[model samples]
Target: MSEPTQSSPTRPPTPSALSSRSDRQFEILILALASVIVLVFVLSIYLLGSESWPALQRFGLEFFTQRTWNPVEGVFGAVAMITGTLVTSLVALAISVPLAIASALFVAEYAPKWLANPVGYLIELLAAVPSVVYGLWALFVIAPVLSRWEQGFFQDPARLALYTSCKNLWDSGSTTLQCFFVPSTFDGRGLALAIIILTVMILPYTASVARDVIRLVPQEQREAMYALGATKWEVISRAILPYARAGIMGGVILALGRALGETLAVAMVIGDSQDVLKSLFGGASTMASVIANQFGDAQEALHRSSVVTLGLTLFFLSVIVNYVARLIIARLTPKGIQ
Candidate 1:
């Protein structure tokens, strides 16, 4: 029995086995790196919160609801700023989404061969232009144009007549109207102008992402729709868009995020006022714009804390918005569509 015990030799791992093992190791490494990145983000939030606690504790909940922002008196609240930020971003999205989608579809599926590349390039080029330059251009050129248009429209008897009915119901003499209404003849540098600037800045981002997603639609799916005697519009509306909607949504969310955080251009064009105006022609300040305008000059402890708190608010708000957007996209897009 002892003499019959013969052991089999151990075999070396094959090339494929080694390769797979190494690939898994690389994946694990990348995952660890990503975890570290998340940790850093958490740490940044912690620091900002800690720095902002002074003002948070001082102002309490009033910090969020109050509209006054006076640094000399050490009084601050971000309601108006938050409202301005949300309004401009929403308006920008409303204006840009249709234009961006149309431009993307044209470049990806309909433009002549000679025109497509140039159009795409121009979109990218618009994105490459500096924010400061856009601000300068808006200040010098677009602002005056907008002012003239606004004044001209409001000065028209027909346009003024249309608003006369609402003016009575809304009570133009009330404090509410005083806080919001801009007299229609007011010059540029308000919510509408900021929205327009943000739209221009964000257009390229959405268009480029949409075009890429449209290009990702499987050729076979499009062919099948065509074989079913579908028109070009039908194929795109029925097949291409449904397949690429998730990606398109992601792109729009990114553009919205950029619009929310835009600082210099918004600061330069938003008139740097803390008025909580509901009208597009009324001047208002955004969180980013206020921080850009006041951070350096904020020598008071409370003033500095308030600015930091604004930044912190924006950071957390962005995270929440992105999470909600992802959930919406996931719910709207069909299973296995992406």
Candidate 2:
């Protein structure tokens, strides 16, 4: 019976000894690099933690929420700076995202290739300039320009009506016979300046990445939507945005990371006030610029430690923001689909 049975066909060679061996080698190399990257991250966190742990222990969580930052009293609260950083970053993102996506869509879907490259380069060049230049530009050029413009916008009667109450309008026995005193010039330096400069800088990055995402969308997908009676805008809205949401969010994440760490530009434009306020026009410090401006001159050890702690705070906030962006994109991604 054994002799009668046909001999089994020869089996294939082990993958370990054949084409898959190269894959294994590449994977091992990638693992080694990944390990190094992880080690670097851990080491940086350890170093910062070691340096700032004393201040953290001394101040406890109170350091984060306190308003005052008195060095003589050893009192340090990051609340204002934290508020400034978050608010300005949010403003910049709000200003840039819609424009960036729109530009990307237009370039990828509507604009001629000849026009797109030059325009894209022009946008990208903004990020190439030094931050100090941006800061100077903001202070000298951008702030005054906005000061003039927003002075009118904020003073508009329409805005006054939109407000919950017109009661808050200037009412110092107004020189005018008007019932509601029109608002005057707002602070040109603080959030307005920071947001504008940040928007300019982040535009290149956000637009570039978004453009790439739109470009990656298959032509066939757009055509199929068109075949089903979709207009160009409809096709992009239904097909392109749905497919490229993750990529656009990734760009936003990248821009946010860049904006948060920005120092010189923010420092120059964000009027150096320690006070926190509900108004975006209120001047305040940010963690990066504060440390940059203070660390070298900080006389006391505790003061230096506090500045370092601010740096650590910035790092932590950045990581948290990045994680949140990832979670948002993940949630937005279509399940059981690419």
Candidate 3:
């Protein structure tokens, strides 16, 4: 009779329901945070554009095309700054990309765990170093060494002849072209130094990203390659790199973004010259560097607005670069990989 006593039917716990609820909460939290980031970006663009409208009205389209920048005369043009920004970033990429990829391959695929951990940590730590500190190092240490090296490297007769020919082909009205024909004074306080410093600064970021992307290649893929009698280099070149190309391109764009936006280090080494760089050895100014140098001293409303406009240009450039990178990544990624 006791055993026959009725008991309430037990129900199993609803694990799927709990998981679904948790996932929805997480998705909502993530969506809210992402919305905050977009809001901040839009707010920044609005504020900058509002401040820069006066300059845009006064200068019209010439603000972008003209090269002259005189605060006293209420005249300003951003061509030199824009050219410096583009050249420094491009040269930095050219110098750093190969080194970064090589370092990533070595650390991620070849190094032992003991070596990889410390090396990777050190690479990441380089990004944490202050830009001003890098500036100081460039000014004192690298500048002197580079100044010496430039005498032999840049002043060669063949190189100068090639440069002159290139300059002749450039438009006479081109501010960037005018920079190339300038007298060769190798002070090592201009584009060359900026490019080199930027290369060093951006290398860590690119390498770290590439290393992670490369490491993401599944072990099974590598094993399959190995079973096919693939050499280490073949596996890396064909399997790893092909699979990771999209992510690597993304890393390069991120590095370019950093280079484009760099202010303190570039300002310090670029000689703070508003002139377009005629030579890599000459002093130059970038949009970010010019803004940093002049923002505090800008007295006139137009002057302040011009600086703000430069900031806006940099923001737009970053957005465009990232967008292009995304497109490239999408193209490179296979349907299965994503």
Candidate 4:
């Protein structure tokens, strides 16, 4: 029995036992890397809040309600800028979402491989173009066409009379009537132009994300719908789109964030007016546009703080938008996936 006895074979280490010094070091490294983003985000908020405290103290809630922005007079408010930002972003979202979704559907479901690849690639490439380039293009190419149209519209006697009547109503304390007609002074380089440029600028973001998400819908979903005698459109609308709605929504929100934060392009074409929006074609300024246009020239401490406050407001606005988007996505996502 002693002669027959042998040493037992060695066993492999368990996963827990296999955690070596290198493994721990790698994990620590990953954790440190992940912490950097959070650190940066918190630091940004702190810096903005510190710099903007004076403005916040002085204006309180009035900063958002007041429309005046006079650096020389030491008065500043964000109502006009905030309105412009929201209007431009929302209008751009409304225009881009449908077009982007349609393009994504065409590329993902209808187009053959030969066509889909190129079209999808081109759409994705649009996002790579710089904002400055889009501004330059819009300023030189698109703005002139819009200006011509405006000139023609104003030249018509009937339209001119209608605008005059609206102006009379506006002067008679019917302030809301101003939305019905373009400002007589509008030269087309204002809210309408800004909306158009923002729409184009944000289109690629939604399209690319949607295309990828639509493609990811399971084959079984399509097959099941098809077996039930669904048409192609019906299958897509009922089966695939429902499954991919969460992802499509994510893309729409991403585009909206882009429209909200767009600076140089909007500043270049937004007409830079500091008044409340009076018409679709009237001059207006967004928060990002104001910050870009005024920060360097902000000589007074209050003025500088006000500019910083605008930046802070924009930061919070973006955070709120993303948080709302997350909630919506969570609610829309299938329970099984959640």
Candidate 5:
């Protein structure tokens, strides 16, 4: 009484169904990668915060406000280091920005193809050189030159008198203009050296970015200006620079980030002093330089934690710099580019 039942055939998946499945998988993969990056960033912050917690609790606000940093006496403060870091980085920026921009302008607009390629390559090559090598070069080669220069400058009767007057003013509790002119003990390695090295180190970052952005200025824009009988300088100043300014600034900020985080080279050249920045040629320390120099010698737990707190401070400072850079770039970017 059993009749044979026909088996139903299975159908293959439709093209649209397969495509939808693939899209979901790709989305999930991208999301997972992004999530990993976010997780790592969060974990880094957590580690720094936890390690620095003891120092934070111990020092309260004085940690950032005071200038003394004696490990033996258990005294700790960061004002000098913070000020040195800012002064060196900003001064380096001031020195390098114009040179970088000029180099970029030449490579992008003035140079022939043959010259541009080689010049650009050389500029980029500077970035690939290790920080330690630069440190050594600065120490052995640049330091002696600077030391001689300082000696010669101070030998001048007029300059020496001016310096002595400033020193007297500083010793008399005047912290304003006099403090900056009063010279520290002569040494090849100091704030001026650090600024010079930092300028060399960050120059390529800005130059590369500026060159790229300059090149991206539309050919049509240049043509339009030329058709109106605009000179080459006029075209560049009026049409190209305005369009590329935002991107160029992004590069400068990125260079600042590099300058802020630089360690060994800065530490080696910066004289490792905890005193407030008194002169351009004076010994000083930065947050990164102090961390590099002192972390190994920090035998006490609080001392170690204080060093870690410096790291935390540098981290937040870098984060703030990057965030500000993003805001500026976003605000300045042209609508057409967006």
Candidate 6:
């Protein structure tokens, strides 16, 4: 049989065999770690629901659609807080996304090594700053700067004629709107401050992640673009942007979730007014802020359960928004493996 086929002993497990075994063990360990994390949130939801199932099921649809909150009477509606949360987050996104992407592009496309690294560090440092500090700065400094935008936008009789005629913040004129603008931090509350604080809070994470993604576009692709005589802007718009689109979008969704769940900074600046208003400058309260502020002092079963339900709502909203953002971006992407 061909000299017994020169039987060679199956060599003792090689390094590759050891490596594969080690990798499997490591993967199992990591999976255990990941599973432990999933357990916490799952358990939390179960416990929270366990505590409030009856209340959640009791009012049901009325609990959500009703637009009034009275703790003494136990008639709580989440409409205002929900609306405020959505509005403020949208405002933050509207303000920050373009700026964040632009900054990312600058760092990835234009800035030299010396400039990019230092500036990238500064952007990261912004994320490290405490939310309360951002709140304090926004209240003490930025609010006054932004408080002037109200009249400038709402003043035209023909433009925003739907908005009721109202004087500036100082006049104390009974306003359908909670805030009118004349540049004052004396009140220490306004949507302007909330938006600015949210923007600052989101900018670093969004921009930094985007910059990393943009950097991942291969250098050869850029060289080829230049060889084709594409202009700088044209190359970015065509090559870098399309390549990094998904990653940039992922960053944006994460940032949106951050803005939605943000509590302290928004709470500090939101003026915390319950009355819904017609203007962007109106004082507002977000769902997270309401939860953080009231969860401690909510002394009744009905009250506590209602707030918990609101918490669930906020959580679901974030989930849905991020999901939709991902889906939209995915659809826009060209068909290929990224």
- Among the numbered candidates, top lDDT falls to 5
Better of 2 and 3 by TM-score: 3
Tens-place lDDT per residue, model 4, 5-89, is: 4445674343453567668889999999999999999999999999999999999999999988888899988998999999999
Can you list the residue pairs that collide in candidate 2?
none
How many pairs collide in each candidate, listed in order?
Answer: 0, 0, 2, 0, 0, 0
Instruction: Give per-residue CA lDDT, model 5, range 1-338, as digits (tens).
Output: 33335534674444676778989999999999999999999999999999999999999889999888888898899899989999999989889988998899999999999999999999999899899988999999999998988888889998898877877765775555655754566777889999999999999998998898888788998999999999999998998899888889988998898899889999999899887877777789999999999999899999999999999999999998888777876766655655
Inter-residue clash pairs, candidate 5 = none
Candidate 3: C-alpha RMSD to true structure equals: 6.9
Candidate 4 regions exceeding 4 Å error are: 1-34, 162-180, 184-186, 323-338
- Report the lDDT tens digits of candidate 6 across residue range 283-334: 6688888887778999998888877887888767777877876775566444
Off by over 4 Å in 1: 1-43, 154-185, 322-338
> What are the candidates' C-alpha RMSDs?
7.2, 9.0, 6.9, 5.5, 5.9, 6.9
- Name every residue pair that clashes in candidate 1: none
Q: Provide the lowest-lDDT 10-residue window in model 1.
A: 176-185
Q: What is the TM-score of each candidate against the true structure?
A: 0.77, 0.74, 0.78, 0.85, 0.84, 0.75
Comparing candidate 2 with candidate 5, which one achieves the higher TM-score? 5
Q: Is candidate 1 or candidate 6 better by lDDT?
A: 1
Candidates' C-alpha lDDT: 0.84, 0.77, 0.86, 0.86, 0.88, 0.76
**Model 3 lDDT tens row, 1-338:** 12335555784344676878988999999999999999999999999999999999999999999989989999999998999999999999989999999999989999999999998888888899999999999999988887787666647887777557656644464445544644345666888889899999999978987997888888888999999999999999988999888889888988888899999998999888776666767778999999999999999999999999999999999899878767765665554555
Better of 3 and 4 by lDDT: 4
> Which segments of model 3 are wrong by more than 4 Å?
1-39, 151-183, 323-338
The candidate 6 region of ten consecutive residues with least summed lDDT is: 177-186
